[model samples]
Target: MVEANVIYVLVAREFKKFVRDKSRLISTLVRPLIWLFLVGGGMSRLVTPELGMSYMKFIFPGILGMTILFSSIFSSLSIIWDKEFGMMKEILVAPVSRFSVVIGKALSGTLISVIQTVIILMLFPFLGIKMGLLSICYAVAIAVLLSFCISSLGIIIATFYDSFESFSVIMNFIIMPMFFLSGAMYPVNKLPHVLQVITRINPLTYGVDALKHVLLGDSGIVDFPIVTDISVLAVSSLLFVAAAGFLFERKK
Candidate 1:
């Protein structure tokens, strides 16, 4: 009961901080919107009808992944900010278990990512992607799972960097490769053998593929099994949360 209360307090604190930051909220929406409209629009011209879906529709899952990826990972920046301002130390010295701290942070990041992704999801009608109730529910579930995995991964990464600058550099290096290689923008099967292997190994690829399956249904390009994708994401989320907890406990 005490641990649960600790988790709730920490999560509530994070949400309050997120809500107070208007600029951060807007910036989070803008990047995914730009990619969905501007970049997806331009690419739609060159992409052939042979692909069976418009580029906009094709990249929808990828854009969702991008939204979740950026939101989840950047959420960790709060840790660096808190540390710089000594807020983290105050929390660290509190009576809560390190596992509670990690879980609370991960859940908070997941909630933020899901909120951002839902905003993107609302633009689907404008983007020409048709989704039903079941699809929307599945997408939300997948987003929640993926957000947890990515957020936990972010927290683990955050434990290593006390400075925002260094954290930003590492995030940039990690985010792009993960996003591009996730087969979010293109069909994974069509990629070269080596690239296909790389995408297969990337956890984000499964998340994107799962989203594609749920959102686009039978029209989705990626034929990756939904069951497999969900299993991998669930396992990955557990692993990442455990890793973050372990790291947080050892932090100075």
Candidate 2:
């Protein structure tokens, strides 16, 4: 079969799994809402107006980043599931290239993350976060790039573990630090020199910075140039996919 068909099959299978899990679907739709309200509500008073907006508004882009972060990364858990249940073995031994398998998994995560991001975007109006159509379009564009980049990263990580239990343990150690360091909740410049270097290296930091550029506009909170964010994510996605493909091929 064609690689396109492989990607389609994998994407559809994941989509079906996603849809059938009502709890996950609800949680995915609700997680950002909780953060925006529960966390953003309390933090707003403590936050300063020098941010050029309310704290909730200031963190809207970050909330979007959070949505993509969790959704894209966890979607790769399907690989561990497939591996344990014997499905992944058949897939790896198939005539298709391992790159096709990796692309299939990456696209599955990307699709789910993008859907969750759009759901979060729909809340912008309700939150008094007025954005034009082009801004929304731009935000979605970056979400796609970020989602693919993150999903590729997740795939690379998933290749290392064959069990869901082990993967979950490792994810806990990595995910929170990645979010906190990504400049999602605070400015990177305010961080110490060590943290500043770490955030610069995080793909999500560039992604959130890109979201700030497109969403916050002249909020003056952006770190890197928009081109830098896109370049890093784009290049990283390719390299990560290549790495995941190589890893998957080696497992054969």
Candidate 3:
């Protein structure tokens, strides 16, 4: 009960911070929009129908992944800010278990990422991506799981960095490569043998593939099984959360 209360308080605090940041909310939405309208639009011209669908529709899932990826990682920056402002020490010295704090932060980040992805989901009608009710629900489920995995990863990354500048550098270096290797903008199988191996190893690849499977139906573009994607995400989320908790517990 005590742990639950601790988690609840911490999660609520994170949500309050998110709500009060109007500029952050707008920027999050704007970034994905630019990718969808400008980048996707330009690429659509060169992408042939033989690719199975329009480039805009094909990249929708990837944009969703991008939304979660950026939001989850940036949301975790709050941890560093807290540490710098001395708020983290206060929380760390509290009576609550470190595990609860980790869980709270992960949940808070997941919630924020999921919310951002849902806003992108709302753009499906505009993009002509037709998903049934069941498919939409499945996409949301996958988004929540992916958000959790990414959020936990952010926490793990945050544990090692104290400054936004340093963290941003690491985040960009890691996040950009993860997005490109994720098969979000292209089919994984079409890549070279070495790139295929790399994409398979990237956790975000599974999330994007899973999203494509749900949103695109049995389209030949996504070669991975949905179960495999979900299983990978579930295992990754657990591992990241465990790592974050271990690091948080050891922090002075």
lDDT of 1 by residue, 1-252 (tens): 128887788788878978998998999999988998899989999994867878888898999999999899888657887888899989988878989888888889999999999989888887677888888998999999999999999898888888777865775678888898897888888878987788887789999999998877767486578999999999999998898888888844
Candidate 2 residues 8-107, lDDT tens each?
A: 8989999998889899999887888999889998999998576768889888889999999999998976788788999988987778877888899999
Regions of model 1 farther than 4 Å from truth: none
- Please give, for residues 76-139, the per-residue lDDT of candidate 3 as tens digits: 7689989888999899888889889988888898899999899899899887788788888999
Candidate 1: lDDT over CA atoms? 0.86
lDDT of each: 0.86, 0.88, 0.88
Off by over 4 Å in 3: none
TM-score of 1: 0.94
Q: What TM-score would every model get versus the actual structure? A: 0.94, 0.95, 0.95
Clashing pairs in 2: none
Q: Pairs clashing in candidate 1?
A: none
For candidate 3, list the clashing residue pairs, or say none.
none
